[model samples]
Target: MNMLDYIDWRGDLTFEQDGFNEVDNLVFSELAYTDMRDIVPEDGSRALTVAQVYGEYKAAGIDQSLMMNDPLPVLEKAAQSPRFKDITVKWYVDKIDTEQHLQFAAVTFIISDKLAYVAFRGTDNTIVGWREDFNISFLSETPGQTEAVAYVNRIAKLTDCKLIVGGHSKGGNFAVYACAFCDKDISEKRVIKIYTNDGPGFMNEVAESENYLSILSKTIKISPDSSPVGLFFLSKAERKVIKSDSKGFMQHNPYKWHVLGAEFESADARTDPFINMTISSWLNTMTDSNKKILVDYIFDSLEASGVTSFNELADNKWNSFNSIFKALTKIDPNDKTDIASSIKKLIASGKDVVISEKQKNAEIKKAEKNKVDNEKQE
Candidate 1:
């Protein structure tokens, strides 16, 4: 039986399938918990419950039977296998079906996709702020991106058809990286287009390479109108701007991508304002040597801190400067220069650093109150 049949074939596991082929509802009968469905839940509060899985199926309305039955066990089997298994960056590969050529690579199965989906969990190997005592390391490399690049290359070597390279968030960035860095034959043969769906822009090290430039024409970056990811890594490359119904988290959802007649409203989106400002602030605020030192310190601190996932380390609140500082410190903690101190000094340099809508409103209100008071006195 297929993974789908194995997981949901029981009498109690009944659910109506939507016209979109998405599950409208999932009922877990007693007979549905087969051996193939067994999976060790992730530690802490990050674990996915059975009901949650069903809920995701209902919400996404996408096929996930193969992923559900095969992913976790396949990962377990692959790890225990003596061949093609390594503990580095926690690698696992599973086949969708023995008869089919489909496969999946996972980073602990936090999210599962029905089709080809790749994503990078940012801050995978870096600690930030108060997560030190939570038994999570903020230092370590996510070898998955490198492996994915290699995988794409291997797939290209086997096929000559146009390959649709795509990913969301960090995975989207990696898709671009792999397309750029892969062998020339692969680049020429099958890599027709790359869809970076709200992915982080490349780091400074790889931004200007010729390989990256080669695929610029084929690279299409799609992001929400006001994107948080774009605010970190700025790029002037190909951009497709989208509008989201909800702000922040809602914008990140693919479903929110505006679909017009034959195209979305992605023609005008460009680099993020925040990224430009940060890079500019860094350059204008400090000397070249200090910039070098600070950037290096941040990279090294993050590398040394070693975190496995962002869910373990991220704070409930969002502060741009603090977020960047945490990322840098996790990369290189040994650099003695204090990131917060430097940022504070830079902010004190008579710069317009604050972008506050509320503050602006308050100023307008105060001005109106003073005008009324002056009229009364007159």
Candidate 2:
């Protein structure tokens, strides 16, 4: 069973009954992805209770199609639960800038009178959101992270309650950034835990910062066994690998995560060494500037297609592919060559890791065969 099932089973139980578990973390993290713009007050100076949001949502007769598809069901389920129905949700913020390649969203949930969870929205379907994600690899601070820090500080000042910061994917990265770099007084005194679910790590410089180290112990990082995004860059936090029903990169979806009882089903370790190796090798080979250039060109090409969201681009796959191909043709020859070469190197790295693993397995099989032969001879 996954988070939705868990909620149905335990919906009647309050935090006083079951206490907050990892399953609740996943629920809150997933809830962050909901588009709360309409439900939230324009000034965001006041908080809205979850029951109030649900009432408003139903009153407006807003279709599920208008909401983010994955989180819509989760939100509906959470709103139905007595445990979470009365939670006060506020400080909703969503910002996007195509020119700056920035996308950021966050909301605060006052789970109890004394406890609050600040859930940062992860990378959305927008091309700009994906671009900002790529920028994390090279830039010291992306616009999303900057805004996240400010948001946390603002929320902290507005309330004296303990804060739990968290997000899934890019949102997770923002949670970590806000927890680490927000006002030290607030982080030290009020912030309790930071949760990052399948979130990518920061650049080496940021990872080594004093701010990061200060709150490192309170950080809890969870990734699916076959995670690609979570394994990107350098992570000093020990990961709690969880089992997933989905294969390959599709495992990045939190809905695919397996849960039993009040916690996620755990995996002993990550399952995709080849993918991890290929990404690590490719990232190591490219300079920060070159990585930025390739990412920029790729997304710029997508923008040329006149599609803003991934769903739009994906719905018209052929046209999107053609637009990307045409845009590639328009790029400088040097950049084209570099991008091609980088892709080739990534492919080679994957091939090498796969072959190495196969050889190792073969050797193990041969050794087992020889041992059996020796036993027979004896």
Best by TM-score: 2
Cα error, candidate 1, residue 234 (Å): 4.7
Alpha-carbon RMSD to native, per candidate: 16.3, 11.5
Candidate models: Cα lDDT each: 0.41, 0.80
Q: Give candidate 2's error at residue 320 in angstroms.
A: 2.1
TM-score of each: 0.46, 0.86
Q: On residues 41-124, what C-alpha lDDT tens digit does candidate 2 reach at each position?
A: 635676777767777776877654422325766778888898888888887888999987889999888888788899998887
Which clashing pairs does model 2 show? Answer: none
Instruction: Show model 2 residue runs off by greater than 4 Å.
Output: 61-69, 273-278, 330-337, 343-378
Angstrom error at residue 344, model 2: 6.5
Clashes of 2: 0
